[model samples]
Target chain A: MEMYWLLGLPLAGGITLAFWGHRAHAPEINAAFSLATLIAAGWLTAHIVAEGPVLIGGDGWFYIDAFNVFLVALTAFVAFTTALFSRPYMRIEQAHGRVNAARLRLYHASYQLFIGTMLLALTTNNMGILWVAMEAATLTTVLLVSLYRTPAALEAAWKYFILCGVGIALALFGTILLYFAAEQVLGAGGGALSWTHLNAVKTRLEPVVLQLAFVFLLVGYGTKVGLVPLHSWLPDAHGEGPTPISAVLSGLLLNVALYAVMRSKVLVDGALGGASLAGALMMGFGLLSVLVAALLIRRQTDVKRMFAYSSIEHMGLITFAFGMGGMVASFAALLHMTVHSLTKSAIFYAVGHATQKAGTQVMEDIRGLIKTNPTIGWGLILGTIAILGVPPFGVFASEFLIITTTMHQHPWATPVLLTALGVAFAAMFGRVQPMVFGETTLPRLPHQPALLPVFVHLALVLMLGLFIPGYLAHWYRQAACLLGG
Target chain B: MSLTYHLQVVNLLAALLLLIAFAMLSQRRIVGLITLFAWQGAALATSTAIVAWSTGQHHLYYSAALTLGLKVVLVPWYFFRLIRQLDVDREVEPMINIPTTMLIGIILVIFAFNLALPISQMAGTVTRSTLGIALASVLLAFLMMITRSKAIPQVIGFLAMENGLFFAATSATYGMPLVVELGVALDVLVAVFVLGIFFFHIRETFDSMDLKHMERLREK
Candidate 1:
């Protein structure tokens, strides 16, 4: 089945690369596996569109529906393109003596494993497996983040491990509590842990227990979503890890974690007979993250860290939109997820090359990207403009929908949202403009940078901004409905 | 009557687990903390086994064995080796003193019990009374993590938190499905291994396992 291949390819690639990842052609092999995964994801999306939502494996251990199918395709696509970017980027890292062969093997293998775990987290029907897969994803990336083994890198990785470890442990406690509630109705067994079964009997489940469980689950998974207050690990991990890892961390991993939170929100909403409580908590966290991250963006010296903060800001915006809890808000949230992933990863791709050419991650030290390499410079400028929600970009379209919906629904929060967006736009545009257009004495590197993935992602973002295709719009509507108003 | 007797034994073990969690909170030596962690694991495994026998949930028996194998024997052995190899068995001063940490732990225990009351009242398992203690142990371990500045003690605190979670699962819901239980067990084991690997890397980079050396990374 296409589902099996979609999950199997990255896993198989991880195992194989664990052995052969030190060779000269390992990056290509990594890219090949990612491409295969993307193809399988495409096939699975087509199958889902034709066949409707269905469960896979025995007793439906894997669930595929309109809600997650688009995300699956998006995760796979960005992963493949990030792999292509990493090929030259990592080689340059090696040439610069930052890493040796064995570390690259570790990097490649862990990258595949990380992708597989995230995909598993996305697709698993059982809530317990979702927790397991999410924890596994954290473990793999912890190693990748510390691959350079610098004091800063190790510190970032350790903070990521301990904080996420504690956060996820709380989530498991919540899962146990959920199972406790379900065992009273569904009775004990694996069936008690299945999301499908829990959703069916949600109204009959105990509301008090569900409320406690959702609190723990939100705080637990929200740590991974990089929500404010729990977001210290986000900027550090992104700043210290390899650029490719940063791309996926910002682009795919955060989205997957948010997906988990949203799924839990649905069950909690049904049990509570309204979305009011859950939506309020999410709105509080989301608005706070956007405001905090937007202000913090102005203070960043490292370009990657600055962009990392930008990621938190966008994720916050998406979370706030979802928390608004309407069909229009949910659709806009989905659109934001897609465009943010594409645009953020493209920005990282450009930043990765720019830093490599400048030989440092500090913003002030790097200059004249346009004079050094026009493609990467333009890519950085275009990607930054798009990400800052410039007109005729998908980000602007999604943000427009979100703001208008917020205006009609919750007028009081509009000024806060506008302030955060305005501050973020100014901070980001001011910082990036000088880097892209200013004069510099930087020389070109030996390896030609991979600009194709950057443009490919930006072009798609552009097309999405200008117009929404019929089928994609329909797909978003379906997903929005499933997420509930 | 027999069910009540088994429940009593589970309750006793749960109390012992909480007591040991408090002991871990007050302990200053890294070696003593690891020892306390092992004791906590032993108490958790025994309670899980007793619950399994009383409830007739066959899967929990396997979970108990796993706790015995990994938590009691393997992880402790590995930690002992790690401490010996790293030569970090010195006294670890808490950021907050022992008295302050213990006082905070007591408050957290009270808070946890209050939080768990409504949920525990709804749980149907015979061992449901221990849910509060289970949650308290988790909170106490978290407190220990926060108060300690050394890496090893913090890791032991994390492992102890997992033990508390396992205990909660067994008491409140008779343990998860065998597959999920196995997956959680494996993840914990891998987490320990990964953190252990980082232990050496951190030491190699900083020449000490103290977390204060890791203070360079912050927004400037």
Candidate 2:
């Protein structure tokens, strides 16, 4: 019943937006409704932590364990905040004549449906169904990405569709292979595709076959996770799409996709007699992506594109943490997932305002944001500091945990990571802070959002840096057990 | 060995698929590529039917039917319409020339067969040897995507690769469920619609469907 609300509420919101969201008041109402939903989601996630794993259907089809509940809560929280961010953003687009009532309605509808599919993908316990839901999420976003119908937006949507379509096809093939291996043990039926059943039957599944499937699955879904060598589609998608879509792309969608990969990692690690080789593979890719993104961030002049790289960087760090594969590292990875989603979306929200106010995404041209729009200027300032992993931000806590864990496991790997982090920190913040503070003040803008969501997200990051709630910490410990198991 | 007999036949069919896929890869004319794709799809449909008949999985006939209708008939029809509407009979040719693409296709075949050897050994199916050919066809299609400088040929590459996956599915497990086959067929249909729109958009944006020109449009 509770899980139904978790999936159905946003779906209902999506339907309402589709049918009747054209009125001027609809955006405000949608914003408020989503916020209430987020509060409920927060409560439900907290309950899951207190009660351990919650299985809502037969065969544990909708399991909310510690590993995922935090993600659900974080997803809802960012989604709510982004919705808040979108209310002002869309109105600004409206007033500027970029979007009409119809486009706004379409945007709201797709946003909710997008959130729904992502939630479905994360919560479902059937691997086959999980793959299908993830693919559905991809398809929905293709439409959303192309919602503007401009040529570049259309092309960006096409690239995203083709690359991700092929990726999902490979993932389906991988899922099939996994079922084949399960047929040998669990028999050739639906039981082979169920996550709970596979977890139970992992010992009996064939190692070679499982290894093959794992490779395909990782490469396939890892495309969506925006891992290097397979991340080409990401920047274009983020750069060309609307700001709200960019926020969702970085904050929720990518994290959900990584969650899929991590679940598969758990199964693969179990199959391969633990995370020995898998750890090496993930760490190698993670480090490569980190280096690539750090180098790429400085070269980018588009602010949205730059933040997109920051997203890639943070995702790389999380991947590295998980790849390190200890209980401590996995816990840190989950924590980082939560914090990164919040910080990145907040940055995007701030960037959205800056892009509108200065009327450009390029860094060299736009300046004097501190003089022009103080709320947005301060948001960028704090978002940069938080994103750079300053000591008093949530990102700092996660980064410190990951580095300390890496130090224990492979001490030599630490310096390389720190160097990459430092380079990225310098590259991102150096440009961001100056762009906000430097010369080029223009005429003041007429409209700005209520700064609550930005402040709330920044405060959460700050609080996470300072302290974690007791239950969340306990949940992370238990979730780490699941990761190790 | 009686066991390896079906393997040999599967290997032969796979080779045929790869050869045609490579031909499609090198083919400069849009009409020629579509014809190659049709042949590839026909091969896939036939192979799936053979596997299903031999395995006595009646549902596979449904899979074969869906493949035949969607890949062979419907998609090719759409491609022709798209080709006519787009008026792009002469392809711009890929970044790589014909000889180069053919050479890459050969390497892909060798790698695919090597990759398939162990998996085919484990499979109980008589046609398991075709896995290599299916993989080779897939790789060839990927090579086609890499070489082609036009938007439509890339779409064809995508369609042809789906053919390879279908063949592999048939050889490995008889076929996927009827529902899955239907879903993929619908997906291919929708994908066709989407690509058709993209073709017009690409032409409008850059005045040519040449993907190389659009590379300039990549965000710096």
Name the candidate that leads on TM-score: 1
Best by lDDT: 1
Residue clash pairs of candidate 1: none
TM-score of chain A of 2: 0.97
Per-residue lDDT of candidate 2, residues A189-242 (tens digit): 455667777888786777887788878888888889888878888887887788
Per candidate, native contacts kept equal 0.83, 0.07
- The numbered model that scores best in DockQ is 1
lDDT of 2 at B58: 82
Q: What are the TM-scores, per candidate, against the unseen true structure? A: 0.99, 0.92
List model 2 lDDT by residue over B59-78, tens digit each.
87888788788888988898
lDDT of 2 at A333: 89
Model 1 DockQ vs. reference: 0.85
Evaluate model 2: give its TM-score. 0.92
